[model samples]
Target chain A: MRFSALRVFREALTGHKGWTPTWRDPDPQPSYDIIIVGGGGHGLAAAYYLAKEFRRARIAVLERGWIGGGNVGRNTTIIRSNYLLDGNQPFYEFSMKLWEGLEQDFNYNAMVSQRGILNLFHTDAQRDAYTRRGNAMILHGADAELLDREQVRAMYPFLNFDHARFPIKGGLLQRRGGTARHDAVAWGYARGADEHGVDIIQNCAVTGFRIRNGRVLGVETTRGYIGALKVGIAVAGNSSTVMAMAGLRLPIESHVLQAFVTEGLKPVIDGVMTFGAGHFYVSQSDKGGLVFGGDIDGYNSYAQRGNLPVIEDVAEGGMALMPMIGRARLLRTWGGIMDMSMDGSPFIDRTPVEGLYFNGGWCYGGFKATPASGYCFAHLIARDEPHPTAVAYRLDRFRRGAMIDEKGQGAQPNLH
Target chain B: MLIPHPILGLRDAQEFTYLGDAALIDRPDGLANPEAFHDYLYLRDNPAGIHRELWFHEQGDRSWIVVTRNTVTHEILGAVLAQDVARARGRSR
Candidate 1:
């Protein structure tokens, strides 16, 4: 049912019984033309684009658990296209454009807030680096502004500008970049895909793949054997484990990244802000709580929980950035497994196994790249070619020494 | 999490820097087999259960130790000096 103001008014007058479930809970079919593993934001979005854009029929998205239960729900919900590399900027900018029209296109309230995002600089060298990054962002046709100290101070005066060690110099602001209601994004895509006749099968865990003579035939699942002509694995943290079922090892490591939200307060933060000297980035949610996170727990783990050291480090970074939030009681905290790649960029390419594709290695940037990741993944799966912007995200780039290392951190998954 | 250091009894994991899979210690001869080197650098087992990883004691003894820990439970199974493992593998500087 299409939701609108009139429908809401009518439903309110009639005891609100007209509302129905957003997406259908469908059982898996005997087989599908295409099957996407892991029905998180990326997988759901891929299914949506596949049905709506590519007009592919008989699509199924298999999820081990409920939708939006993974990193999509656990993230701080920030989105931006302020990357400094050519391999990443265009793809993310396309995602930003998708975000701009997402709510209307999907007919859902995703709360795509483009308040802005500011990356504060602390030193002259940092300022120069941010200046170059800002230029790169502008070169990619994305918005960027180099704000001076006065401008930053005027914008967010609560920041610790006079820190004894790391003084706030300036910031690079992306006026079109901000946060979104992350769970809503997953829901919207899932509903859109469902509306396009894609089966979203939950509570179905894929146990193994049925490969024969170097080609994938189907998957062995807890539900049963679900055959598919083509299979795409979009499982973020479990990329390695799932692909291993197909006898392939990936250059990905899973690490737990934790996020925190504080007790509700009056709105303070106007836009997303990142601490240059530290790993803390924060934004005030619509419900008034401050949502923030920092570096991932630097270890290989499949667990959804993190240790205390990284928590202390993130709190320290928050204190260093904004001393005012020191007393705000942390209402809750949660962790999600991240798929950290060798070169710190994602892979959206066909695996060595025929009829099998892979889309993972998002590291800390999965939520922001959801739209483009899904759209490009769908394009690749449908046409058997890489999207123009995602041409550099090849699986063999590491072996060829053509890595898109945004941080130039080589071969270290945790560092990425 | 506490790392049971081979030398020091038990050290806080905060003092160490993680470098991931201990297979990194078995560096392939680049000149002999560049393909093997590529595989060594890129591919990983990345198991969800027990993982033997390399951690550098950056803040404490500055020693590189291999820790056998369960990735699911975060339990430390054992710890040994990476140098010992390297010597056992017949490698010397």
Candidate 2:
């Protein structure tokens, strides 16, 4: 059933019982043409595009848990394409364009808000860095603006401008960057994939891979052994654990990144804002809760919970930016396991094992890269070639000394 | 998560920086073998239960310590100076 104003009006006139499930709960078949592991946003989007664009049939997405049970549901929901690197800017800008038409294309209300995002600067060096980044964004067909202190104050007057430690100098604003309903993104993609005849199987955890003479056969799952002609893995933080089952070790580490939401209040923040001197970035949700987060726990763990010190640190950063946030009671906090790559960039390439593909190592950028990640991943799986925009995401970039070190942090996963 | 430092008693986990797997202490000579270096730098044993990891006391005494902890429960079993562990393991660097 397509959602529209006419449908709503017709249903309101009737008994209002005309409704259907978002996506069907389908059982796994014996085999499929293509099977994607991890039914998060990327996997589901890949399946959707593979069916809709590539016109592929017999596609299936296997998930260990229900959809939206992973990082897709546990994020701050900010999206932007303000990147400095040539390898990253164009790709993210493509994602920004896709996000612009996502709601109409998927026929679901994913709440793709373009309220805008501001990255505040504290010092001269940071201003120069953001200036270079904003120029890069403009070159790549994405909108950007550098706002001075007066302009920033004119926009957000309640910020702590007179703080002694870190004074706000200026900011780089992207009018197209904003937050989306995270879970709704998952649901919309799942529904779109199902509409295109892609099977989305939940609670079907893949246990092992069936490889023979370097060619892939299929996967062994909790439900049963399902055969596939091609297989792709996009299990986010579980990238290493899952790929290790196929005798391939990835340059990835699992770290728990925590996020928090405050008690509902009147609208305060107009758009997403990040601290220049700290790791805290916050935005007001449509429901009025202040959603925010900071750095990762700096430890390697699969646990989806955080300790107290990081919480204290994030609170301090928030207070340092806006003292008004100190009064808002913290409602809840949650953690998501991030697959931090060595160079802090993602990978979308085929493995040495033929017919096996991998896509992960997103670090803090995964949520923002969901649409492009899926679109490019689908292009790769269908054509057996890397998308032009994702040529730099090759898994062997590190070995070849061609690392896309966006943050210039070398090969440290935690630092990235 | 309070890591009981062998010297400083109990310290907040945030005071230290975590690096996974104490086995990384035995660094392979990368110039000798590229594959060994790749394995040494990338591959790691991400077990679910008890494991030993490296933690730097960045905020406190500036000592590199090895902490034995459970990844599932976030329980710290023990913490010892990595220098002592390295010396005991016959490692110079």
Error of 1 at A402 (Å): 1.0
Candidate 2 residues A1-416, lDDT tens each? 89899999999998788977888998899999999999999999889889998866799999999987898988999899998898888899989988999999999999999999999999999999999999999999999999999999998899998789899999999999999999999999999999999999999999999999999999999999999999999899888889989998788888889999999999989899999999999999999999999999888878889887889999999999999999999999999989988888899999999999999999978988999999999999999998888989988887887888888987678887
Per-residue lDDT tens digits for candidate 1, residues A20-135, read 99999888889999999999999999999999999658999999999888988889999999999989999999999999999999999999999999999999999999999999
Model 2 in CAPRI terms: which quality? medium
- Candidate 2: chain B TM-score equals 0.94
**What is candidate 2's TM-score against the reference?**
0.97
| Model 1: residues with Cα > 4 Å off, grouped in runs | none
C-alpha RMSD over true interface residues, each candidate: 0.7, 1.8
* Deviation from native of the Cα of residue A135 in model 1, angstroms: 0.9
- TM-score each candidate: 0.99, 0.97
